[model samples]
Target chain A: MIRALISRIKQGYRTYPFPKKEPVLPERFNGRPVLNHDKCDNCRACEKACPTGAITSQDNKVCIDMGKCLFCGDCTSACPKGVIEFSKDYRLAANIRKDLLVSDKEIKLAQAIDKQSRRIFGRSLKLRQVSAGGCNACEADTNVLTTLTFDLGRFGIQFVASPRHADGILVTGPVTENMRLALKKTYDAIPSPKFVIAVGACAISGGPYIGHTETSNGANGIVPVDLYIPGCPPHPYTILDGLVTFLGRR
Target chain B: MSRQLISIYNNKSTDIGAVPNLPIDDFRETVINSVNTGRRIAAFFGLPHDNDSLKLIIVLADDHQSILHLASTCVKEKYPSLTPDCPQAHWFEREIAEQFGIRPEGHPWLKPIRFHHSYTNNDVWNRSANETILPCVTDFFRVEGSEIHEVAVGPVHAGIIEPGHFRFQCNGENVLHLEISLGYQHRGIERQMTTAPQNRLIHYMETAAGDTTIGHTMAHCYIFEGLASCSAAARAQVLRGIALELERLANHTGDLGALAGDVGYLPTSSFCGRIRGDFLNMTAILCGNRFGRNFMRPGGTAYDIEKSHIDDLRKRLNAALKDVTNAANCLWSTPSVLGRFEDTGILNKQICSQLGIVGPPARACGFDRDCRYNFPSGIFQFKQMPVATWDSGDVFARAYVRWLEIQHSVAFILDLLDSIPAGNIQNKISAMSPCKIAVSLVEGWRGEICHVAVTDNSGKLARYKIVDPSFHNWMGLAVALRNQQISDFPLCNKSFNLSYCGHDL
Candidate 1:
């Protein structure tokens, strides 16, 4: 017991003061990607190098779909004129799917739910996390929020085990066909006035597994997603930001 | 009289014709004989040979000699089952029967592994092509007694975990049998690897087992390099090694915390949880992604550590290790935590060997079966880290072995970071040689991660097989549950902490 106490003291208070103070992200962390269309020569090198077809030249404009991007920075390397580079802006979440298409303009970030829904769930939001076919990276990062460093409970947000007790569902995966029925069943089990948040590139736009017969693209057609958080697997801060912002607490 | 198998080293490519081609009967006999002589079955899978035949390939590892043996046979429909004679071939045979439309006749248990349609038009179970297949909806092993009750858990579990179904037959509190039925997380990764766009191949490999991103991607990179008949430079190899060990350190630390959490020990659980993130953050310092995505390429690592970053990594690692030490020591020093861990879910060494388990669970059973030690590749070929083992084969042993590995991995990373050689971080990989087969093994935190690649006549990837450690270790968890208390399921499950999608894929 003494050792535990001593160790607890040595560990100290390690939680980040996000929103109040900017968190320390790594120097190399690539959160949101920016495409410089002025420098692009329509070489199509980025389109070819993209593993998920996230980069494209549409209407004579180069656009990167953050929902489909793995945040791999391959497009940046393929671009000869420095047309593409990922910025350290971690705020990559949206209420609508089309907003995730970053084409030089800033992304209209996620907004809080409607007045009535916010009034009901703004405080003490209980979520049921469903991983349809996630690679566990999304699941792990989302799960990290409950740790001391993130302490999600302080914001009255808790991940409940049963959907019956949840105000919403936060899903991660490409939504494989095998899990389609199960995911639907889970979403249905939650009470009415419930919302769904799709986390990760897989859940938002199927990530790299898009257009596969085995997967249903993502949570789009399976369930109506209230928020979209994009990354190969979004970082913990991104997830927390999405959650609190959707709840009107951020 | 002919050679039964061709010998090859890890991460080495060989001519397809050099592998011995035997008849199905000889192939079965040779595989059984090799297992009897204490060889391990590394990978066994079937690929389409022609419209009518399926070619089965087996890669056996002679760990004592650090050699890999390969052989193949073409079977039109059926092959004699190797599971009856060699228990290690059980899962592989079941997987082959599922993937290809071949029947492994006389097998004790023949059931669908991933609940997906067979690769060929021929259906082994004679299920119609149009009918949609559902997972874990089949008949399971039954124990008939009025007192024996069955408990069914889900594809959607209570926790934030991957999907899988678990059915337990219990006589009151004691479990008689625990059958695990998975495939809910199947995204057809293996199928995609064969047909996906070239650029997407590495992305699929990165998520093959997402938590082991570095490990699985390292295996794919080695396979690609082998097919190209090139190797990563010494500096790149060392960087890859550092990333792999960091992955190991992060996972082991997390597992230890999870094991403690399962036992309701909060102090260590809480501390280790945050520490796990710290280790992951350190990984982000090297690569942009915490899971090390986009850090590995075909020839070498995509990113190289700067000198200042190396010092930063060393300092952070030391700091995290110190905290983890205190957190882990709480597990050992606490009698109540040890009580729940020791003598719980005991899987003896014989069952572990028979089941062909790998990783910490196998090491916990006193088998020094680490791929890094037995099948050296990359930086492992230059430097050595002793295999950590524990003999109890219980949950305590599993947790203890992870702790030992954590210490060793930290030391390895620190030592390597201090002396990272100066060289190029990547090599330009040229066109791969046609009609060649290559095998790459990486000791992922869970266990041995095996990737076998076969290039066709046009230098396209003909077949790619990934054998995640969870594939071999899941059965061990089921067997461990036998005669154990039903309430201890979470504790035992956390100790093994096998991957659902890795197995399903």
Candidate 2:
């Protein structure tokens, strides 16, 4: 125990100063994307290359749904004209599903929830994470949120074991056919005035497994999702920022 | 050496014509005899051939000779089951029956491995086509007595984890039998792989089992490269090797910590958790994704590591290695942790070999089966990490073997960082040859991951089989649970933390 304490003392602090201070992310880390229309021609290369239909071009207008975008950067690489590039800005959470759309109009980041939601779940939010068909990358990042670096507990967000204890449910995976019933049961088990936060491209959209027929497209038809946090598996910081965006808004 | 089976090289595509079609009895005898004679059956599956007949293809790996034996036989309606003789054939046979609706005659304990409608019109188990095959609602092997009790868990677990059901027939805390029911996470991956190597193929490979992104992706790429008769550049192979080792380091470290967590050893658990993230961050340094999703492409790696990147990786790896060593050594150094781990859920080597367990679980039982050493592919062919093993086959053995491998992996990665060759990152991959089968085996962190792809006449995938390490080890977990204390199930489970989706697929 003394050796452990000594080791701990030597290790020092591991938590990052997020929101209060900017994070020094890895050099190659992919976060939020920025689109440049001037470089884009009518070429549908990006649309063709996109695994999920996250990047869609219609009527000479291109839009990227942040909920569906996995941030895999295939669209950026597929575009011969170099139209799309990702920025390090990862604060891409939204309370409303529509707020996640990055279209020709404007990039709509995640806004705060309504006054009623804030008044109820603003102080302490307990989440029951259900991995319907998640590949566990999302699950891993979600788990990472609890670590000292992210410290989600500082914000009064905790992942409880049971749905009865949760204010909302964080759903991952593509909502496979087999898990559809279980997900519904889990959602139903949670009391009224609850929300579901669909994480990752798989939960928001079916991701690469979209057309596979095994997955239920995504979590859309199963339950009412309040927030959409997207990534192939979103970064830990991204998940933290999403939670902060939802719960921190006054 | 065998006359009936046509021998082929690993990662080399064999011509459909070269694989001889034998009689059912002869095919069964060949597979049975070969398995009895020490060679393990790498893959066995039914692919449609010869105008609607189910053509059974068998891949046997002669680890010592580094040769893979391939043979096939056309069977209609039913064929003699080799599972009664060869234990490893049980899962593969059950999978074949589930997928193709084929009846394996005289098979013991045959049931749906993955509950689904068969590709064919005939239903093997004879459930109505329109009815829903409920997951985890199967006939579980029962142990009924005056004092016997049953414990059923998950498909919906308490923790933030994957879904799978476990049924334990217990006699007051002692587990009589453990029946694991999976398929909840199945996304028809093999069915999806039939039309693969597409723009999105790599992503699918990476997500097949999320934790095993590098292992699965590398194996799929090997299958692609093999059929196309292309080898990745030496630099690409080295990068892949580094990625694989780093993945190994991360997972093994995580597992060791998880073992600590299960034992309620908080310090090592907390420290190893952070160190695991450090290793993941190192992988993210290479590719932009922490999971190494885009790192692996068909012909070669999607991303390249620069000198500066290599230097950075070396620094981080060194720091993480120190932290991991400090944290993991606590498991062995502290007597309390060892007390909980040692001789708890012991699986004998004879049972493990009979059941055909792979990866660290097999190594823990002293099987000496590390694919990196035995079946060397890519960078492993040039450089090797020795087989790490322990004789106990207990939780301590499993945890200890991982710590040993983690050290070896860190050393191997550090050494490779210094000496990785410089060349073109990728070889030009042309279209694949038609009517060919190729196998790629990688010793993933979990164990042997075998990916077999059979291309059609038009060079499109007709069939693809992915046998994840979990597919081999889940049953072993069940076998290990026999006569063990039921409360220790979680720790025993953490020791062999098999992938549900990998097995479900």
Candidate 3:
């Protein structure tokens, strides 16, 4: 015990200095969805692949409701150009609904082309995750995001335990029937002006498990979603990007 | 104890004097005959088939095993009660009653186990014959004592943990009986999986028991592979084995820490917890998501281990081992911690074997059963890993066994990394004809995780039943809690750390 205390003392202030300096994330960390319009081919694979309908395409233009996207990375894998790749940027904090949505017109096509070579990076944003009938995979990933190496806090992203203090809700799973009440209660508990980011295939169009008469389609079934991150289980980097996009720090 | 044994084989047997045969209609008579012969009832597994019928298979194990199958038609009729003869089938009977709307004719307590009342109709059996929704209800047990004040704790705990309720019948601190009520976290994973298409079933399988993701998914995939006559690639199998072992290591470490924390050993608790965190970080590094999400796909792993990643993992693992070993050594050095845990919450070998407990808890009580070694699958068949066990059957014995297992896990991981062959991480699985039923049994961190899958003619899931280790071990908790002081409850409960969500589903 004495040795442990001594070691802890020596380590000195290991807590991430968030909101000041950008936190360092691991290599494979999945944060948020980044749309590569050049290679997108305007094919709504990502829009169709999304389980929560977080991505909607109209007239060859795609728009991501950042409030609903889960950052599961399904779109990235399904996309032919690797265009919709996961960006390390996780600063997804927003003051209002309009800020979270990313439209095709919002993309600076020329800027996106040049930025492709500049290794994707961003400051960490505080994440508040809700288990809206999730099987707990998304929760597990969100929990791991704060570990030593990933040190999401280092990126200024902190996972506040309470919804009142949260900037966004990182939702996972295909909102199960029993969890519907709990989800509503949690969303209501969180003070408004709070963004909602759906994080897994379950949260996106219910992934492959949609159409279950027993479970909800996704978080949007109960609350308005801002971003859709897609994957059977979204990669950590993708989750980081979604958070950053919400923060407007990307 | 033998009274009468009769075996009659005929094409049609329904009347009282008729022989037991294929077309037997009366299930009550068969059950009565079995009970009259002094045969002890074992277990009953409800197998739901694609034809909308139910296959209730009961086992009577005495000196020999007599398996009885009662195939009920799709007429939605209530079956005769077996609990009157076999008191142990109380939970199973209640579950089957709630799920399939097949009432155990005379079950004294026929409460719903998983589903809520709002979900299913009061006359569920008489309702639409093919209805899938079931009900959920809480049934409290009667407690007897002087001024027996029943205090209910949780559905929401003080700490960050899963939800479960405990009804403690106590006179101040002196406890009379403890009744555990779970299912608060039930998300109806089984019902959701049944509705999912075959190709997408893996998503549901991974979520069935989140912590036991790889274990459950492997079992689910194995069942599908077995039914489809397909095999995962050797590389995929080895990768899965590695992931499973890592899961076991992380959980055991976290549990050990929690156990120590329950005993008020903060130093040991923090140290072990930090080690667990490190392990979780390692998992994140390899799979991109910690707690092992998306690691195991149907035919193989979703992600492959890069050479550099393996090297990084080896480094982290070595450091973690050193730290964890040091922490455990410190814990052993503290005499108070050892004294508090040594003989607390003892479950004797006899009770353990009778209850058919599995995994570390059962191993601690001297029952030598480990699916990894006994029922070898994948690379486990080729590797040499020690199965840790102890006969003490106490809290300390369980902790010691876990400590030993963690060491074994480290060794196994190193071995796997050293011998990992270069190959494709995944393989393509072809479609197969429906009406195929396959069962998969895997040794999870807790115990055996069994998944039974049946596919329809269109290659979609007709029914999927997942039996987590926690379901079988819930009884172990009741037995362990008996006669123990209320103060020792946390220590006993943490020693098991059974997943309420896993069990409820």
User: Which one wins on DockQ?
Assistant: 1
Better of 1 and 3 by lDDT: 1
Model 1 off-target regions past 4 Å?
A: none
Per-residue lDDT over B46-131 for candidate 1, one digit per residue giving the tens place of the 0 to 100 score:
87888899889999988888999999999888888889988988888888888888999998999888888988887778888888
DockQ by candidate, in order: 0.84, 0.68, 0.21
- Residue lDDT tens for model 2, A157-241: 8999898998889999999888999999999999988889999988887877886677887898899888888888888888888
Q: lDDT tens string, model 1, A1-250?
A: 8888988898899888876877778898998887788887799988999999888788888988999999998888888899888888998889999899988566699988889887778888998999989999999999899999999998889999899999888899999988999999999999998889999999988888898878889999989998999998898998888888888887
Question: Would you list the rank order by DockQ, best first?
Answer: 1, 2, 3
**Worst 10-residue stretch by lDDT in candidate 2 chain A?**
A102-111
Give the range of the ten consecutive residues with the poorest summed lDDT in model 3 chain B: B8-17
Error of 3 at B246 (Å): 1.2
Least lDDT summed over 10 consecutive residues: which range in candidate 2 chain B? B192-201
Q: Which stretches of candidate 2 lie over 4 Å from their true place?
A: none
Put down candidate 2 lDDT per residue, B80-118, tens digits, no spaces: 888889998999889999998889987898889878888
TM-score top scorer = 1
Indicate whether candidate 2 or candidate 3 has the larger DockQ: 2
lDDT of 3 by residue, B103-193 (tens): 6788876766655432233243454535443223355775776776777775434333455668777777656677776665566667767
Model 3 lDDT tens row, A210-235: 66655677777787876666554554
